[model samples]
Target: MIVTSYGKPAVVILSVEESERLKELDRRVLRLDEMDDAQLHEMIAAEIPPELRYRIEDIPETP
Candidate 1:
């Protein structure tokens, strides 16, 4: 359920189990954010096998 203020959702209500699951997910994201750049890159690369990766290049700015 959602509680609203000024027609905008202000708070959410969830079952105990759902709340616990969301809390765990939040903790996991926090841990990932704390990882160093190299560690994070390694983890991402490990998830996607070498066959599927592609390089991302910046596009030149258009005047």
Candidate 2:
């Protein structure tokens, strides 16, 4: 759960499984920082399911 104060996010509550997943993603992000752009994108795509993956051209950089 996300905790909000004064209409801004303050904290998050996560199950043990969710926390573990986030920790793993953090490690992946740290590793990604060392990869070249092409290799980084390839690894991200490979980890995500094909159907769930964003189309290269359809990805958004900003809200």
Candidate 3:
């Protein structure tokens, strides 16, 4: 875990394996967002390897 100088919780640091897994999940989500519901459902049915997935909504949005 990363912390701020003021004794506040900041960003977290993940292990390399977990980080890579989440990165792959992020790529999948970005691609899935453009698809129709059925396609998304089919893809999900195909089973994406689940892992720790999270969104940092506090960050600025980017294309």
Candidate 4:
């Protein structure tokens, strides 16, 4: 939930599980942001190997 002050956002409230998940996502985004353009492109273009097929899972639903 969002808390507002004078028509502006002031604070956010999240469940413990939601907070932890957001923290992890933040960490991942930070790591990606640190990468250079070439590195980011390489990662984006990389193909998954057949050997790792068993590790793939369905995408998670957005909250």
Return the TM-score for each candidate structure: 0.46, 0.46, 0.46, 0.46
Write down the lDDT that model 3 would get: 0.76
Give me the candidate number with maximum lDDT. 4
Model 4 lDDT per residue over 1-63, tens place: 989999999999999999999899987763777899998898899997987655335556565
Query: Given candidate 1, what's the lDDT at residue 48?
Result: 66
Full-model lDDT, candidate 2: 0.82
Q: List model 3 lDDT by residue over 1-63, tens digit each.
A: 575667886778889999999999987674656899999788778853556444687568865
Q: Which pairs of residues have clashing backbones in candidate 2? A: none
Single out the weakest 10-residue window by summed lDDT for candidate 4.
Answer: 53-62
**Stretches of candidate 2 above 4 Å error?**
30-33, 36-50, 53-63
Q: List the residue pairs that clash in candidate 3.
A: none
TM-score attained by model 2: 0.46
Candidate 1 lDDT, 1-63, residue by residue in tens: 889999999999999999999899987774776799998887877766667765665455555
Kindly report which residue stretches of model 4 are placed more than 4 angstroms away from their true locations once superposed. 30-42, 46-63
* Candidate 1 error regions (>4 Å): 30-38, 46-63
* Each model's total of backbone clashes: 0, 0, 0, 0
